[model samples]
Target: MRSQLRPETRIDRCFEALKREGRPAFVTFVTAGDPDYETSKAILLGLPEAGADVIEIGMPFSDPMADGPAVQASSLRALKAGQTMKRTLQLVREFRAKDNLTPIVLMGYYNPIYVYPSEAFLDEARDAGIDGMIIVDVPPEADEELCLPAIQRGLSFIRLATPTTDDKRLPAVLANTSGFVYYVSITGITGAAAPVVSDVRAQVARIKRSTPLPVVVGFGVRTPEQARVIADCADGVVVGSALVETIRTTLGTDGRAGPDTVSAVHRIVHNLAAGLRGAAARV
Candidate 1:
């Protein structure tokens, strides 16, 4: 019998498509209105054209504890600029208008989603063409009531598995996780510190044995070498804090990443993408 596709099938398809083309998918993240709406929009639009396989649009929230200081600061800037969940969805709608193929995953803490009825949030997400969601704070036990509806509505619930996730609990996490599994490479929050553990590859291998899902490693992955190292064992690499830091440095007090921002972003993403592509090229 043919197996049913995951709820967020587009994301799975994108991963497979990139693999077929001999490239480890590059998933880039940016806050929805980081510096301002227009620059955020430009980066989102430019990503796929510039070689990004998937885009994670961060929905800024008041308390982003899971994120490091840089992402928290970015979200604060977006909030101060009057960015709301409504505006973030509008960004997704605007993106869908031009590019419908590249999967877009909305990543953020759970408070904003909790503010809205789950059904309303899922419906709006579907209308805006969001392919998946990564609610950093929601564990699988709580997701049935809080997130399953989105799965029922054709959106992937991407779960985050930490180094602390053991064999007994890992299956439960993967059982509910759809699209692709997000394997946290470190023990704590997102940033450029060296990983807390030395056996991430072993952790990834253990997770892969439990399910047939594509595993994407994230957190503490800042440079091309780090990306290449993770890409060697995982399906993709997620880079957020590092890129956000670059944008933060580029932006002056005026809430803009300055004139040279595009060049800087392109340079960083290009290097990350190249590293991801290296392993695929050899395949």
Candidate 2:
């Protein structure tokens, strides 16, 4: 049964829809205003049609500690291109203009939101049609500061459950986590190494036992086959670094988005989505 403690959100609706289709959600992440605003906006607008079930827009910050090299570089590009918190919210608003069904979750550190003054940022984010948030730096113990407040404002405060999150520590992680539980498939930062499918299966099962929320595995996933294997065991698959790398590869010599940037990224997403759909068909 779905948890009744929190209100039904777009993120909830997305997973429910995927459940009905018997497939795992294909979640994609990209840095807002990477390269530039227009190019980033174009990529955001095309994701849903390209097979992305949920979109995570990285709120560009100077020091993104939790990210790997690819994601960290993407953030730097966005910041160098003048991406700000306001611009990030603007990207969401533009995406909302065309896509109301797809869930948009802002993923980043706490410093930006903290300097945005937190409360005002939440109000603006909600108004801009953001569905949830994955603030990597904030913990459950600091719920009073942001997590609880975000939940109060109808935004799902998603939490990350690492491989090291044992049974004793699981409850606290799930206590305030809504939307879904993001199971970090590996220990280190995003895009470290390929996770062993059997290990991922065990950890995802462990997380499921503790929470009613859907469990989505991420971090080491890079290819369509990997997405398929991971989705076979988890409720969803999140691929970030791979897609960001696609953007990097397709850029022009001067580092701006080339003609193939949008299409290349979409191509990867389409293939990943196909992989997840194939997993569903096998079931």
Compare the candidates by lDDT and give the number of the best one.
Answer: 2
Candidate 1 stretches with Cα past 4 Å from truth are 1-8, 196-198
lDDT digits (tens) for residues 165-201 of candidate 2: 8999899999989999999999899988999999999
lDDT of 1 at 46: 85
Poorest 10 consecutive residues of model 2 by lDDT? Answer: 1-10
lDDT of each: 0.84, 0.93
Enumerate clash totals for all models, in the order shown. Answer: 0, 0
State the lDDT of candidate 1 residue by residue for 87-166, as single tens digits.
Answer: 99999999999998999999998878878766788899988999889998888888777668878888888999988999
- The alpha-carbon root-mean-square deviation between model 1 and the true structure, to one decimal in Å, is 1.8
**Prediction RMSDs, each to the true structure:** 1.8, 1.1
TM-score of 2: 0.98
Task: Quote each prediction's TM-score.
Answer: 0.95, 0.98
* Candidate 1 minimal-lDDT segment of 10 residues: 1-10
